[model samples]
Target: MDDSVRALRAQYGGTLPGPVEALPAPHRRDLAAVLDQARSRQQRELQESTDASLAALPKPLRALIRKALGL
Candidate 1:
């Protein structure tokens, strides 16, 4: 993450990025909405991967999971 930040700063000719809080209300809201959508998509992908892994397990292991989950 630090390397990515450094790369971003270098890409922008060493200028520091402004804080998100410094933006106007509308801009901040837009940024928040985009971030929320991105987070939701990422969470969905992670959940799907977990579900796929669980489905691939043997029945007894899967039953233990369902019992633990109260499903």
Candidate 2:
């Protein structure tokens, strides 16, 4: 399978819509790149929020929270 197909399927929980899967490879690759970037940005924002929310706690408790949540 094309890497673009693989990336897109992974994003969609292991399935791609038929129309998307039928797109030319170049278009699929472009779509995958755009999605990957958007996912990355969202992840970064979430991480920042998680860190900020935990910042007020004492060090040991923060460590415990991070470990408990696998953050």
Candidate 3:
């Protein structure tokens, strides 16, 4: 694997699901960009999901939890 792929696998606990190294240089760059975007979207979705779930709680309790968690 290339250093980039190895680094990604290490950072993400080996869950990255494709062979990024075998592509041509331009395609590799495009794929890397796509992967970066996917990671960003996944993070945003997770944060939104957490916020939505927390919103289901009582307001006062949610406020307290948020304060305690420094959210």
Candidate 4:
């Protein structure tokens, strides 16, 4: 693991918040796919919110939100 990740583990008293590796590989892949879908949905929602505020926000702030959402 990278130093930063190791340091983070140590920061949390050398234990993970959850049993990260307890799940089998197939279950892990399914979990990753679900997380990806949720993240995509979140990005879409953020974009819709920014779109609804197009005229209310300054051009810079709207652009910043779009960039932050990776949209």
Candidate 5:
């Protein structure tokens, strides 16, 4: 396996379920790019959801909650 595959497997606790090395170089790069974009989108969605939830709270409670959560 290549270093990228090995790194991902290690990061995922050896539970990566496919032959990552079998992919052609171009396909691998495309897949990596797509996965990166998906990760970014998911993070943004999570942050937006958190912001919306926090905005629904009263200002004083929100400030206290934000302080307690270190946000």
Candidate 6:
């Protein structure tokens, strides 16, 4: 599979369905773009949540937590 298809599969969390695999290159690329956008948004949201969670911790403990967790 080409990069676009591989990326699409990866974004889909692996092993794309048969229907998706059967789509034409252009449509697959479009789907891949959509999935990429969704993944990016999810990652951004997760990072924001993590930062907020960390910020809620006591300042003195925050550094120790980050170091212990390798964040």
* Lowest summed lDDT window (length 10), candidate 5: 3-12
Which candidate number maximizes TM-score? 6
RMSD of 4: 7.6
> Tens-digit lDDT track for model 6 on 1-71?
87778978877788989998989888999988987888889999988998899999999999898898788
Evaluate all candidate structures by whole-model CA lDDT and list the values in order: 0.66, 0.93, 0.73, 0.62, 0.72, 0.87
Model 1: lDDT equals 0.66
lDDT by residue (tens digit), candidate 4, 1-71? 44433443544456644564455556555655675677779999987876887758787787787677776
Worst 10 residues of 1 by lDDT: 1-10
**Residue 71 of candidate 5: its Cα lDDT?**
84
Better of 1 and 3 by TM-score: 3
lDDT of 2 by residue, 1-71 (tens): 88999989998787899999999999999999999899999999999999998998888899899989997
Error of 6 at 10 (Å): 3.8
Q: Model 5, 29: alpha-carbon shift in Å?
A: 0.4
The list of candidate 2 runs beyond 4 A from truth reads 58-60
lDDT of 3 by residue, 35-63 (tens): 77898899999899989989999988998
Can you write out model 1's per-residue Cα lDDT over 1-71, one digit (the tens) per residue?
A: 33444434444456545774356656655655675677779999988987898899997899899778765
Using alpha carbons, what is the TM-score of model 2? 0.75
- Runs of candidate 6 exceeding 4 Å displacement: 1-3
Tens digits of per-residue lDDT for model 5 on 1-71?
56566545544566565666577656666666677677789999988998999999998899888888888
Please report the candidate that would top lDDT against the real structure.
Answer: 2
**Decoy 6 TM-score against native:** 0.77
lDDT of 2: 0.93
Candidate 5 regions with alpha-carbon error over 4 angstroms: 1-18
Model 4 quality (TM-score): 0.52
> Candidates ranked by TM-score, best first?
6, 2, 5, 3, 1, 4
